[model samples]
Target: MTTQSAGEPGEQGGPLGMQIDHVPSEPGGSGTPGPPGPWQPNLVSTPAQKKAAAQAIEDHIEPDTSKAGDHADDETGKAVTAFAPKDGDGWVTSTSLKSAHKTWGDQVKNLMNRLASEKAALRSTGLLFQTTDFGIGTGLRQTSPLDGY
Candidate 1:
């Protein structure tokens, strides 16, 4: 188990602020064997860090999507419909505009949903790591000769 210090809480380290302990040598191949010693955590997130990250996503990213989506809708829906009413001149262009508007709206909605899920995942990350570390530490402690004291 390699023991390298992790980044300070809430400080982004690597790209995406993530680490992977092992990876397969090739597709369908086994990953690096488990360490002979206790597990070492290379990435860590505190409760405050998780909360702030999730909150930032909610406050900044989620709200901006509406503004952006509305801009696209107005440009595509209102402008196109004005120039080419659906049943009149430039009807083909109007139909195309409607399709584009719907596609843009759907994409925006999908992005918002993905961001929400990511925020939820971020909020729970600290707790998940704490629980996992505690369980592993407890198991390792039980195997120690020091426990006989």
Candidate 2:
């Protein structure tokens, strides 16, 4: 339930820009483990529909290849990992971009609402939810043929 403050919406005082770790638990390990109790955020039940919806949502994330796709770079001999800021050792966002907090919240909420709707659609498929799988393998990158990665 941690969220940005109603007022000031963007700053260190508020929790707006903070990235919360969302660990999607298994679909149904509770009780008898036969049927899914409910459609949890991270838990994609056995039916491929639920998993497919989750996959689509994940693919929409426009990953910063320099920060993400590092695995690919390692094999290709490219250093994609960001180096620590010479100014300090720990994480620190540029002060000029402080207002980004509010924007980030808006983006996350919009994506979440879309994902929720997709999950609901899967639930209506009339199949028992047996297992959950949060698959984020199929990544989508908008790369131009001119800009070789």
Candidate 3:
């Protein structure tokens, strides 16, 4: 379930229920204190997100949560991105951290296992070695030759 916590998947294949609470703001007060820095819009995960997930796993075999994604000064400023959503542009999910880690580990392991089964000729030329990047955003394998190897 989506509500997994590392070792076991929950009954629902996801967290049992998802709820959101917006942080309260003081009356007549802005969220920022200084000028905004370089504007880097949040990189949204497209419907075809399997690729991104694969990349994140390869680049970061173990997510530290402290440095998951891009961290530019946001529009509202105030170091807001540390809580940006893991999937798209929002907030860090309250889902089980344990489950997320296990899931990521399995993905990387499976890819490596598959790579091990490849024919030795191609494997020697640069098959498995070519795909590994020790970085989450770069490890994802490209589906099209048009994309970089």
Q: What lDDT score belongs to each candidate, Candidate 1 first? A: 0.76, 0.48, 0.43
Between which residue pairs do clashes occur in model 2? 44-132, 46-131
Strongest candidate by TM-score: 1
> How far does residue 138 in candidate 1 sit from its true spot (Å)?
5.2
Better of 1 and 2 by lDDT: 1
Tens-digit lDDT track for model 2 on 1-149?
45664565565565364457654465545434354455645443566766676556556532332233344335323221233245566234433233343454456566667666766666655443222222222233445697875
Candidate 1 Cα lDDT to native: 0.76
Judge candidate 2 at residue 73 and give its lDDT: 34
Predicted structure 2: clash tally: 2
Rank by lDDT, descending?
A: 1, 2, 3
lDDT of 3 at 36: 39
**Worst ten in a row by lDDT for model 3:** 67-76
How do the predictions measure up, each by TM-score?
A: 0.56, 0.24, 0.20
Report the lDDT tens digits of candidate 1 across residue range 1-149.
33335554433454234556777754444655565323444566677887998999999989998889988977786768676854544757677778878888899999999999999999888778889999998987676687679
**Candidate 2, run of 10 with poorest lDDT:** 129-138
Cα lDDT, model 2, residue 146: 78
Tens-place lDDT digits, model 3, residues 21-109: 44424333353443433453456434335344555544564343223321211222333344446567655432344345556556656
Per lDDT, the best of the predicted structures is 1
Runs of candidate 3 with Cα error greater than 4 angstroms are 1-95, 119-149
